[model samples]
Target chain A: MTQLPVRTDRKLGLVIDLDTCVGCHACVISCKGWNTENYGAPLSDQDAYGADPSGTFLNRVHSFEIRPDEGAAQLVHFPKSCLHCEDAPCVTVCPTGASYKRREDGIVLVNEDHCIGCGLCAWACPYGARELDRAAGVMKKCTLCIDRIYNENLLEQDRVPACVRTCPAGARHFGDLGDPDSAVSQLVAERGGIDLMPEQGTRPVNKYLPPRPRDRIGADSPALTAVAETASGFLAWLDRTLDRLPGGGLARMDAPAKEENS
Target chain B: MNPAPSVIIFTTLSGAGFGLLVWLGLGLPGVTGLTAFGFFAIAYLLAVGGLLASTFHLGRPERAIRAFTQWRTSWLSREGWTSVIALILMAGYGAGLVFLGTRWTALGLAGAAMSVAVVFTTSMIYAQLRTVPRWNMALTPVMFLTLSLTGGALLAGQMAAAKALLLLSGIVQIAYWKLGDRALAGSGTTLATATGLGAPRAVRAFEPPHTGTNYLLEEFVHVVGRRHALKLRAIALTLAVVLPLVLLMLGAGHLVAALAALCHLAGVAVSRWLFFAQAEHVVGFYYGKR
Candidate 1:
């Protein structure tokens, strides 16, 4: 008779640091490269370098400029993918039981063979993590590099996911979230990490460290405020001189004026 | 939200089908000849046809038989089973009307109750989806029942006026219009509660994760303007409810009543389409699209 494995209270997940991330998009690319070659099917693109190109991607990075009223604009890059929630709504609403949570590690995954491509699970998900692969006739999502993470041949530290290992900024960390002593768990507890949409009540396991408080860039900065002011002042002076001259101020009509003379 | 053409046709067609059944059941005692039997057959055909059209919306149509198995957990399964029962009841009621005469009041009354139950069950299908805030309200069921009655009464009134049964049809049509208006306005808060993120605060989306549109955007992220929704609602109410009421009150005959029914159906189709199209799914919060 086959024996079942002993139950353990251990859940492995990711913790992302927003302050150190430079919006490099290396994680997104690495995830796609690994999953496309390793997973059930490659993320198919409708058009390559075409007007209406669309395809499925397991990860994406969003860039936003967060400007508080009192401080300078902070360019925040948010890397988004599946959070692998403890109370994942996507698994329960699935009528066919195709989408399920792994009892061993708390990783949520889809059994593509059982999925009918009905898209009901996608509708039930409040996080927008699931994507339907129209060409493959199934739903696709981030597996957190399941094939690479558990390979025994690799060294213990090298068993990290493609996204976490490839992150140049060291912003991504993966470990056992269930253990209070784990580095990721400690960072979350100390840094006051926040869920993206807590009101949705999905109870996502992944946590995001809040962006560091941005310092105000003085109006003296050469890139934006200083350059804009100088350019506008010069333009205004030229316009006033041009108005004083005969026939709209230019000696030659319809011919471009030299920058030095103007 | 994306309006799948199949769903639009299914709900609108089924509304008309069930609406026709409700009217026929109400008027069985008063009407006679080929007219009574004709109305009965038409209602049965529409009900079956609408049910069939709804099946096209399922991902696995071949496995549709499994839908009947989940009545304990799924309202969709309940609607399916109840509709079938209602059909059988209508068949028995139709046979009695043809053979046993109008004296079979008990059978007629039972058929009417079943028809009403079918409408109620169909509405509950949407009302039970807890994920969708707009569809989970009590008004959803009330709207379905009222709309069916309104549509059925209008059709009956037109048919009766054509056969010179004016007084009876007129009364039914007027009653349906009033009930429908109240139901439409009464359900506003339910929709607001579904989408409203209480107390206005600036929640800016800095970056979206993906460059391309995903399943969530394709299914639920509709960007219809506020002004457009208001204008469409006005058009729908006027064409569907107001015009029909005025025309019927003016003693319009069967042909006019038929024309009014068509206009009302078109208006109801737009209204129903907006009901699904405008519904905001809470999942958009993750993508930062809403």
Candidate 2:
């Protein structure tokens, strides 16, 4: 089971648009809530109410503040889980016949019954996707909601992953990335969705849509050039420009508040 | 990565055990029925104890038997299987050496092969970790093999062989650490590359995904203090390699050799702690550690 199959029929994955993501923990919660009771062992929480609360989670959202030189600072929210790579290091590092990638859809998973929870699989993963359940003594991870997606017990519309289904901003898209005609593939092609850490050679199934570049300031908006050359000079014009300014000057960064270059 | 005590003990102790068994199997001189009994007893106790210690690292020790299954890709699996082969062969060879005064050459050779093979695979377990660039060196296996052979020679009281192998292992260990430290320092990853911030710019974490520690933070993000690491490395080298070489140079008997072997192991243990402690996992980049 450690040896990966030469090929998989379809690569099922998720595409998350960083531009639209609201830095919400909904997807993380939904994944924990469902997987805690769904497919495998419950994701255990140690010291949930005590001083140090820690637990296993299949999904996480990392937020970063990136200050590009030309534009306003952008807050990039990254939602990460398993990439379910074709050449998964997590799968190969498993000493037990537990971690395996599905040949049908390329979903990397652990067989709780067979897992020894040695943590080698977790260590092997570059993405930190694999999480160990302390209570159950087994490794758990994003199953791509295999139980929900393929289950005949649910409606076809609700067959998508719990994270995708519960995303309020519609930032998460689930589909067959392998199929060229699939909607997710087309979205990836159009929006230039990129793989996280492609150098790792994980060939992660998930793709992240980069945040949209903010458009240059419009003509109607008062330009920084309109401000007077000196701080005292700007005090005279500040009253006039105050009405036209968005959300008042207090909420904004006044360019002319400081001394200007001679 | 945390230098779990169980793993550090397992790798070094079993490595020495197997190394000594290799010397015994290779038909070392002055190995009589009494000596053979002592060698086998020491080898099995250390090997079996180390293997048992590894089970404690597992979340479920009862299911450790399954670890012997997947040998095709998992170096850990290969280590388990190789240990079995080495132990079984040693048991058989020990029986022969004990009951009959004569040794089985073929069985001894096969047992020795398995013995060295286990240590090799054990090194591969760390060497193969692409996540830890410092560990993924060809030197890793060589280090393990040399250390095993050196320990074996020391335990068998082969003063000359132990001296030579100890020196070789010392040079190799220093070389490995030197190159490994450079490799870690020059690793290509950064917060920009990790988060796909694109265009070289300083990326800072505005807020962590969570307030409290998660499994990833606990397991993957071990930032060793630079001063502490330097001090430990000095101690490790002095104890593990330099001390052993100097002691063996005295050309003394089993008493001196035994003390040297003990010192070598202590040094190796300290070095092993640095091995795990200093390793920077790629996941650390995600946490903005590097």
The model with the greatest DockQ is: 2
Task: Give TM per candidate.
Answer: 0.71, 0.91
Candidate 2 residue-wise lDDT at A75: 84
Q: Which residue pairs show backbone clashes in model 2?
A: none
Q: After aligning candidate 1 to the native by TM-score, how far in Å is the CA of B182 from where it should be?
A: 19
DockQ of model 1, rounded to 2 decimals: 0.13
lDDT by residue (tens digit), candidate 2, B1-290? 88888998998899899998998889885365876798899989888888888888899899999998999889999999999999999889888897687788899999999999999999999999888888888998999899889888888778888878888988998998899987764666567666777754656767778889988877778775434988998998999889988887776977888899999999988888888888888887777774
**DockQ values, each candidate:** 0.13, 0.61
Interface Cα RMSD for all candidates? Answer: 6.8, 1.1
lDDT of 1 by residue, B213-240 (tens): 6656777787664337767777767766
For each candidate, report what fraction of the true interface contacts it reproduces. 0.22, 0.79
Worst 10 residues of 2 chain B by lDDT: B184-193
TM-score of chain B of each: 0.80, 0.96
lDDT of 1 by residue, A1-262 (tens): 0011133266778888888889999998898888888868787666647776677777777665544555555566778778887767666545445567787887778877666565756766655678887678678888878888998988887688889999999999998888999999999999887775565566778888876666555787665323343335778888667768887745544336434445
Deviating ranges (above 4 Å) for candidate 2: A218-262, B185-187, B224-227
Alpha carbon lDDT of residue B148, candidate 2?
Answer: 85
